[model samples]
Target: MFAQALRDILQPLPPKCDIPQDEQLQEAMNTLEVIVSLLLKEQFDTWRYEALDGILLTVAQRRDADTAFFGGDCILITDQTVSPIEVEVTLGGGGAGLVRVCCRVGEKQDGKLMRHSYDKEHRYRTLIWQERDPHHELEWMYFVERMYDENGR
Candidate 1:
């Protein structure tokens, strides 16, 4: 499922003239929904949330390269009384995709959110394009778990 969804996003669309930009955006958004859904179920399910705001996916053409990359963030609505937790995902462009997933699981303290001594980050590289990649799944799980721990949740 992960590989298929990633492939849908990574696959090149019909050239700009052939496909409308809005259509491409919709397609990417759909694929991103699938990706984030998978991550939520497989990685961050342990974190209880009353609701999840829609994932925000951003895709941009790389100025320095031919390939484009994607980045996204989702707010997990944990408790109505507190601020939502934010989880972000960044995907790099290439035949071998690289993903960075992290989460901020805390309320603002001293005008800073999760301003801690340790920087919890996870980086993973896919084995190949359009292939099942567990590297990213593991990285995402580790990132969320670490963030949850750091936040004393």
Candidate 2:
């Protein structure tokens, strides 16, 4: 059911010149709704409403607004409401066929980053994490464990 919905939402559309700009905007809006709905199911406390403008601005970056694709970063507050998980979304040119959503979890100070991206060609999601100090990777692991533990409490 979820897969079908995603497929429908991301289905290719007619060329930008073929469709009206308003219709293109509507299509982008619909895609945004689905993305937000999926994100809400996660453990984030809340999404920052002000960040939405950034997404629109990204879409408007191109000279031709109708053909402009979306690319922007938004923050999802952690369950404890002390930190933020950044989600960066980018769509392929002309607004359909390919999409990339990257989520960064953990702290910059600790030198840990988690990236999650969906590959349209492969039809799969990939999760990759990096740590600066390989020798002390366990510290980063414990940090995440403690964060979840605290959130659970």
For all candidates in order, the CA lDDT equals 0.36, 0.31
True lDDT of residue 80, candidate 2: 17
Writing each residue's lDDT as its tens digit, candidate 1 over 56-144 gives 33223322222334333333444322222334433344433324444433344554432122112211111121243425432122234
> What are the TM-scores, per candidate, against the unseen true structure?
0.32, 0.26
Global CA lDDT of candidate 1, please?
0.36
Question: Candidate 1: which stretches are off by over 4 Å?
Answer: 1-21, 47-53, 57-59, 62-67, 75-153
Tell me which residue pairs clash in candidate 2.
Answer: none
- Cα lDDT tens digits for candidate 2, 1-153: 222333333344443422223554455655653554344434343333312211221122222322223322222223212222333333344424324444433334555333222233112211122212325332211111111121112
User: Where does candidate 2 stray beyond 4 Å?
Assistant: 1-21, 45-59, 62-88, 91-99, 102-153
